[model samples]
Target: MSNLPENSFFESLKAEDLSGVAYKNHLLKKKVLNYFSNFGNSTIQDLSKALNISTPKMGQIILELTENGVVQDYGKVDSSVGRRPNQYGLNASSAFFVGIEVKKEYINLGLTDFKNQLLKFLPHIPYNLDNTEEALDELCKIINQQIDKFNVPKSKIIGIGINLSGRINYKTGYSYSYFNFSENPLSKVFRTKTGFPTFLENDSRAMAFGEFKGGGIVKEEKNVLFINVGYGIGMGIMINGELVYGKSGFSGEIGHIPLFENEIICHCGKKGCLETEASGRALISKFYKKLQEGSQSTLSHRIKSENDLKLNDIINAALNDDVLAIELIDEIGKKLGRGISALLHLYNPELVIIGGSLAKTGDYLFLPIKMAINKYSLSLVSNDSKIVLSELGEKAGALGACQLVRKRLLQSE
Candidate 1:
């Protein structure tokens, strides 16, 4: 029932159906594959030391893996006084995964191999989110184009992983906030249309998986939180090393939480939401509101229309000591801190990650956040959690989706 198998081998195959010999073979093969993936072209001793097993044992696993075509020999590495040992690596080209990030205005598609290398990525393909059928058609078209561009056999692709904006039910594969399909679930429809197995996840949850697997400081830490401040605000929670999906699979909708009792309505049919105050949209809105009132700003000449205004314009201006830009970002950071304070008191997470576009502002954004949290939250709770900016930028959701596909494939195998 566990999604992340720490040992890598225990969940490789079905326990009830596997004989002793068969299960042992599966375990060794999985171990060898995992070792080779982490260290490309590793020798028997290299794998042995990493896995804390004997060289002979590693050699046995490598031989079995190589014979079964899961691994391939990469010549020999000299052992100084001793004879050379053959190095091995996974058959990276044997399997491929497709990950898609779907948004209101655009979609991003990425392809990764068994080695978890992002081989190809197509960014910002425009589409309309409200039209379910048209959206599905566009998705299929883009996927086919990429598949043709890569010239990959359809059979070799393991599965397609999709991460989208909105609330999703893990059990039923339905997104309540978007893609209100009347006939079938998005996953089922996508799978039927594409003729490939598919997995769907909340965009924030997918991004958190990317951080959990590589980006954030979650190594050996159990509780973590990933807050995405893109055009809008979103959050993903990880507790006890597992992504939290509450009863309805919608636990981390922090942006919609009404932090202030104002008339500013949110897109989610709510008033005074945190996102309306602290999100990138809010930042832009605030800046424009001041500009319209004839407020002096260095960005006035550079920005032609509201369309030309982006977060980077504000961030660059702030970095150049522009008081207005810095002030706006600082205000947003304080709001973010308030939201984070609530999370700290509730979850008491070990690490909290700020990701997405606004996170690119780095310390300018973080300093104010730290100050706000310190002022609002209990020292005991705030001191326990360390907040850091996410290393993975826009690629988090797509990469995490592909990684999830790889994980499912490994468990099924």
Candidate 2:
């Protein structure tokens, strides 16, 4: 084993010396760390079998990782063998990750250990996306509060990861779509305020990463499309285990994909975009229109203000068998399905995951989306793909944001 310092991981990335024997050692350690991170607790034999490496090689990797403070011996597994093998798991205290999800109405802050387990989650913090100063202050306060709770050393906190619902340049850490900052860069501002490295990623991409890492999407099935339906619809595409960021990291802007010939202009100033017909905002808007048009429904009696009608409220009404709510969501689901069909034609992904706020509708959302796919998509592509609801629910974005930090900052370091 080399006498390299434990900080070599971070130093190597910053110094750009991740080559030769050091690189190989890094890869081996990362593999071991990833396995333990995924499986929780496992023995050297278990790792060898899982990775198809010889016991001796696996032992060497494990020993090196243990020495580097990346892996820790948890205890012995009670096996009916001569002696129970010692189990190993990631040292969660070794590193920390901070993730923030920026939404229209609020911002969410989360703290996770290197293993991606949630240490703390601060949801629905009052953050007006248009208010730069107030939003920044609120964000900083919540992050500092969480950090204090964890009692982690500043050095252990690798970086802050941010997930937003608009175009973001992950490489430059600049958000061209959401948030307003002049003179000072957002990432630099956050880093200076918090004393940690920072990263910014699109919310959909972050959700896809979360699903890929922990949401039961197998590593071998690398190509996946995650569709997020919230205030608006968006997509995150992963091809060959890498995010399909187009020329400007906006490759998966499926929400703006034209699905209808109608003349409703989208937020992107386009007509007939899928989001104008399928998103939660679209559904709620249409529901209000119908209500005002004297459409008979239980919702009309309950909704005093158009703004009072939330996506979850509509879903609940639909679940309770409200005729108008059910019909409205069913229509939205069908529109979503049509958008997904277009996605199938373009990406031909192995899996299509429906995520975000509307995911709570479950079968009400999925069944109709599936029906639309069956109606619109080609048999070959639809047959090869599986459309499933996200298992992580609303936490996918925050979890994925944390994962972005791990992938970009911690692991590379």
The candidate maximizing lDDT is 2
RMSD of 1: 6.2
Q: Pick the candidate with the highest TM-score.
A: 2
Per-residue lDDT for 187-209 in model 1, tens only? Answer: 77777767666788989888898
lDDT of 1: 0.78
CA lDDT, every prediction? Answer: 0.78, 0.80
Report the Cα lDDT for residue 27, model 1: 61
What is the per-residue lDDT of model 2 for residues 206-312, given as tens digits with 9 covering 90 to 100? Answer: 98988887646445688999999998988888888888898888878888888789999888899999989999889989999999888877667778888788776
lDDT of 2: 0.80
Determine which window of 10 residues in candidate 1 has minimal summed lDDT.
Answer: 1-10
Model 1 — TM-score against the truth?
Answer: 0.76
